[model samples]
Target chain A: MADKVLVFSRFAKSMLARFAEKFELLETGGKPANEVFSAAELADVRALLTMGAQPLGRETLDALPSLGAIVCYGTGYDGVDLDAAAERKIAIGNSPAANASAVADLAMTLLLGLMRRLLPADAYLRGGGWSGARPSPLLRPPRGLTNARVGVYGMGEIGRKIAARVAAFETDVAYHSRSRHDVPYRYVGSLGELVEWCDVLLIAVRAGPDTERIIDAAMLKRLGADGVLVNISRGSVIDQPALIAALADKTIAGAGLDVFEREPYAPDALSEFPNVVLTPHIGGHTLEAHVAMQDCVIANLAAFFAGKPLPYLVKR
Target chain B: MADKVLVFSRFAKSMLARFAEKFELLETGGKPANEVFSAAELADVRALLTMGAQPLGRETLDALPSLGAIVCYGTGYDGVDLDAAAERKIAIGNSPAANASAVADLAMTLLLGLMRRLLPADAYLRGGGWSGARPSPLLRPPRGLTNARVGVYGMGEIGRKIAARVAAFETDVAYHSRSRHDVPYRYVGSLGELVEWCDVLLIAVRAGPDTERIIDAAMLKRLGADGVLVNISRGSVIDQPALIAALADKTIAGAGLDVFEREPYAPDALSEFPNVVLTPHIGGHTLEAHVAMQDCVIANLAAFFAGKPLPYLVKR
Candidate 1:
């Protein structure tokens, strides 16, 4: 008999197959939290495997009386209330570095795509219009990363990886965090200052309540016209109305948004600008990343049953 | 006492303004062939400014008795037969290396835009749809330059610059050229084999009767599945009808096209594909590039007029 697991995750079927051999997997294919509650009416599950799509809240903990631990899929455990988990003395594990490369890749994708007006050219061609031949004269060589100031907010796994990629382009990489550390790049004391300094400001911080709407109109105005705003974090980090206004007024050169506030409901104003490059929120949904995350869930469960240290436990 | 310039060309006000301060400018925006034929009707004129857009054929050339040298603004001087100029010892010069970087940058823009599916996401968002939160699964990262086998068909200056850029991405760059000299990249013997070996085949060769339709139905098929095509050169280099069929049948992953056989007259089939990233013939239109080309023309003419060696001359 293997360790019984509760997998409350939503991913491609290909990712689910990674864990089939290891444990007695009880899975939900991206079902809502309420459905998971109904299904786990009384199942004595050893652990729960959860990711971004499913948040393991206090209610979820209350429902799962026999839950040994909650294995967080990606680096972000924003959905899981750590204080609540500490109160219960339940173990919480997460995979942080597993998807760092994937997220960094996505962030770069957004930065380049938005800055270069990638989508507008496509629209011009597909709409049977020959207008793309005559682009605005303002366009220059896709802004060589060399000698440009690039600011990264949040010096965590994704941010560090992004910094590494930025360095490859010969960019002057800088960051802003709680305290300044001795990194190769400049460590700004304040987020607002970093915004003012960087030609391109990339937000890779967490998307929790504390970080919600952190990049509002004031912060955006600080960036002004010379800046390009790229948001690869959660939608809540930016104020949508402010962003729309900034982009429309050319307060900033352009914006590349992969996530938005009230997702699946984009702002009407953003649609009008050709300068913005928008993508569905898929920062860590690459094939390699999804499989790695799923595999992480399986590894955590195996370690828990073996009475060993969890691979990546979130100690609140 | 002022320098007299014989303007036998159609000129934009922008170009005229650039040279107006220093030279005694003559503005013949569009004088006909027959009018230019009667050069005896004109007064003192020293320089002839010619463009392909207007007729400066044998009769017009012969009639311009007072013209000492012709300064053409474009890179291609197919209109004025150099033999006629050489016989009379009339110096001729055109802009060179003016737009290489700009064109190269545009090529990369198209390449990134097409491979990343930028337009589809934009279309969805602009059509009152939300795509950023729940992204369509990403295709490969344009087969990252790090490990890609890139084939360059024309190893000229633009091609060499492209090769250097691809090399920066850490790709194994190869090329097919006529009687290749020593270069850093591996030179493949044949275009057919180069297409087969490359994950992406780039065309940077010239477009003339000699190289017309070099990439036809059979050549595209050789690229096979998962391969891509990018044409920054003339559209006459590729068979449009064959390319349409290849793309329709998914013979290759996609293509990024900048030039066409006919300007502003791209086939509907090529532009319609979601996989294709199409741009009008504005590859070499960057401000920096245009100024550089103008400078190059000035330098070339300055050398010829000063009885010094010309920096770059077309070997005809």
Candidate 2:
């Protein structure tokens, strides 16, 4: 019999087809594991597949006595409780950097869309505002990408890609991260300094205790009236309430967001802002990205089942 | 006395303030010059400022007996009758390449917006479709930029910039232009070949007799069903009806258009397609681009008024 892999998160059925072909899947359909399966069935589960943004705490880990590995489906592994997993001696693996280019592409998409007033421009044209020769403040010329200062909030794979993409647009790029890497762009020591110095701040940092709610009201203020913010990272990295207040008072010019504090549930207040561009969290939701990520997942799972270390294991 | 400059196109008063400070302005507000000013007044005009897309024919040139210069406000001079200007000994001038970077940026914006399905994603989130778990084929995975083949249809400043921007995304860049240039990208011998080989086609060729309606139905068909098209060049380059048919029949995946054959008037047929991202001709409407073009216009007009050759003269 194939080794059983328990599905611990809500994923499209098609996304798990390959996994099912290779393993016996005890799919919970994003329900509580205890509610979906008996303790006897859970006792046989040796591995779990999960979305990296969903919380996988000690309680859930305790329920699966035979669980030896937890594999995250995407780049992030933040939702897994590292301390709990370490105590249980469970190996963790994630598809790091597999979706970096796709996420970076979306960052540029959001930044350009916000700065260019794309949503309003589309609305204006579709509503006959352009043909009627109606004066619209929304369609007024915005600052172009040339010579704009761009501050990247992380230096990971996604951040590096974002820097490279924006740099080609003739913008000055700088980044603030846990440690400076040997990237071509300049490195800034602090997030506050980076925010103050740049016209746009792009959040690509990993979410954890250190990064959660770091971009608070004070940070938003320093971004200034002409500044724009774009977040493709976890929404917890920014204080959504603070961001909403800053936009309300025009403290910042605009924002482009793919993630929210709550998934698939951005506050209604965000829709009211004319200066913002919001999308459902889909920074890495590309066909190419999915294939790359799936490849990593398969490799990790295959290694674990063969009694070898995961080739894409997440470091402690 | 200051030189008299007749305005042949509609312009915001603020855009003309600098010119007003240096010249005596006769603003026609985009009206017929004959109706806006008497023959005597027109005869006294030594220079005229116009949008490059508006037609400037022999009749208008003959009306201005002492017209020494025709200064186009933007990079394009396609609308100006170069033969008529030469016959009348009028120095034709334009802001060549002043808005190339801005236009190139928009080309990328439209390309990303369309391929990423930005509009449908935005609407899905804003309309609560995401929260409702409604299935949207529009939000399905798109072809990512990494390793994708990108074919540029022109080799001008804008096309080169587009190639550079897409290259940074790790795409395979190639181009087909009137003549081969010393660019780093691979040169395809024909437009049909470029279309066939690439996943995306970016149109950046100039608008003129030689290039009008070049992207007809057959070329689009060669682009294949998964291919995307982004046009930042003149709308006359693509057959609108053919594009509509191609889009309706799924000959192409999607399109992002910034220009149309008619000013400020996109067809109602275009509004029905969810796959396409449409914007008014605001490709070069950034503040920085406008300032650069204005500076060029001032330099060209100043040189003409000083009885010297126009600094930014359009070649005969």
Candidate 3:
């Protein structure tokens, strides 16, 4: 089989450079995304790779009769219709730790940036916004990471990695998980108690059926007004409305979020707050993650052809 | 005989909160920062506690006819005329390691941010930009802290502490100092050679009259384009024009600098690039540093009254 592959996500030219050497890769040409996914085009493809936060509907899955496997370009395979694929025995694969360090690096960056007001302050200086560039009293008085009580909710691969990085700052770390992890840090057995103890709370747990609305108003209240909250996991993992209200009322010091409740959409209330640092979910988007993910995709393809176990079989 | 004291820079309100428990402290809070003479203000005040980049000039020195001691609220005493105070047999004290971990914390944050372009991507996303939010092949992949070559420029308290932290990241650490530090890491004999070997270079050396413009354009290029340059030391330590030209021409890959050549001032050329991450000089501004600095100030004051040796003394 000459192995035809369809790519739906944006990636470095480097990935295509690799694909060109082997597979008959169906590249998403410079055509805008809305023009993609014509039914006639999907009929012959043997494999599909996609990303983002929505499910590729059943109709699209039905259209590709030759599709033998689907590779999620990055972590968070929430968009892939796993049930239909499972029924068809079409394999599904996701690159997990491939983007782990990248996302972990970004989470810490956002935490430091918000606490220090890095972007606004840097922009102020670069734009000549400062006559004297009088340092803000708020910026100067904020505390560093030493001995900070950092709470990690959802102790998974990314959370564990982030904990290791946070520990390097000499921060006291703890986590709330389905059960206690084998790690050495203090593990808080209860969710509310964990929120109360942490100076900074990061949401890295999976955002799904079990995790929806996990950090609601009551949890936000437990986090206290002096605390900072960082969410890079899933948009629904945080209750956006309550978070906005808390930030507006000074019930929380600040927030740094990568995922939003809605894509291409943000509450004006969240955007208006100077203390809240928001990103459009680019945490796992580093070049290092891209190439590693490419390797995993190749591994998955190689296994399917050999009739061996899939390297990263999606649980869902 | 009452003990007389002097203060250099203005102290934060938190200092009063923490230190007013003991000692009669005086601040230089008048107009004409130079005119806010620490020595003159503390003509009779028992202890002088000052902070930040303010100067302890001759007017203040001569005015304090009864002055017996001086205490700095921060790690640096460059602004203080230490020689003149020493000539008068004034006991000079400072807070060192108390503020070190905080600055080291920021250094790592900057290291991760600049190497990863955290702020620019966050800003782009929060501004309603979504195309770049997902991980794509176009993105550079993430690199782990495992086994990377990291260089430390200074061997002072902050540098030493940073070395300990860097080791936790599994980075092979090397350092360049005026003398070979006995720390566990490899000590490079020359600054030029250290730059050549390090994939990531951290500038943590103390700033004073003798150390200005040590890293000129030639040094930046030797690190090569793939190397990351981090400056947590004074802005003047690195030549501004040379760095700006080098960054603009792409001689180096990226830089993360907290202290700028002319702080409240950044290179106009740097603003155009997304790779560089800049912050207002905040290495020592964490809350932990603040409280610890206050403690150091208080300790120095206690030592002055008790006639004990001050922990940190400037070399004349």
Interface RMSD of 3: 3.0
Off by over 4 Å in 2: B137-139
lDDT of 1 at A35: 77
- Please write out the lDDT profile of model 3 over residues A31-147, one tens digit for every residue: 432367566777777677777355575776677887888877777887767788888788888877777777776788788878777777667656665435465534446756778
Model 1 chain A worst lDDT window (10 residues): A136-145
- How well does each candidate superpose onto the true structure, as a TM-score? 0.81, 0.99, 0.89
Estimate, for each residue in B161-226, the C-alpha lDDT of model 3 and write its tens digit.
Answer: 888877765579999899987799999999999999988999999888777898888898888887
lDDT of 2 by residue, A192-280 (tens): 99999999999999999999999999999999999999999999999999999999999999999999998878888998898888889
Candidate 3 stretches with Cα past 4 Å from truth are A10-15, A27-41, A127-140, B1-4, B12-26, B30-47, B52-60, B131-147, B167-170, B179-184, B261-275, B311-316
lDDT of 1 by residue, B168-285 (tens): 5436789998759578999899999999999888888866667789998889999987788888888888998888899999998899998777655788888778788877665665
Candidate 1 pairs with clashing backbones:
A279-B132, A280-B131, A280-B132, A280-B133, A281-B132, A281-B133, B98-B293
Q: Which candidate's lDDT is highest?
A: 2
How large is the interface RMSD of each prediction? 4.5, 1.2, 3.0
- Model 3 accuracy (lDDT, Cα): 0.75
- lDDT (Cα) of model 2: 0.91
Give the backbone clash total of model 1. 7
Q: Score the docking of each candidate (DockQ).
A: 0.28, 0.79, 0.51
Descending-TM-score candidate ranking: 2, 3, 1
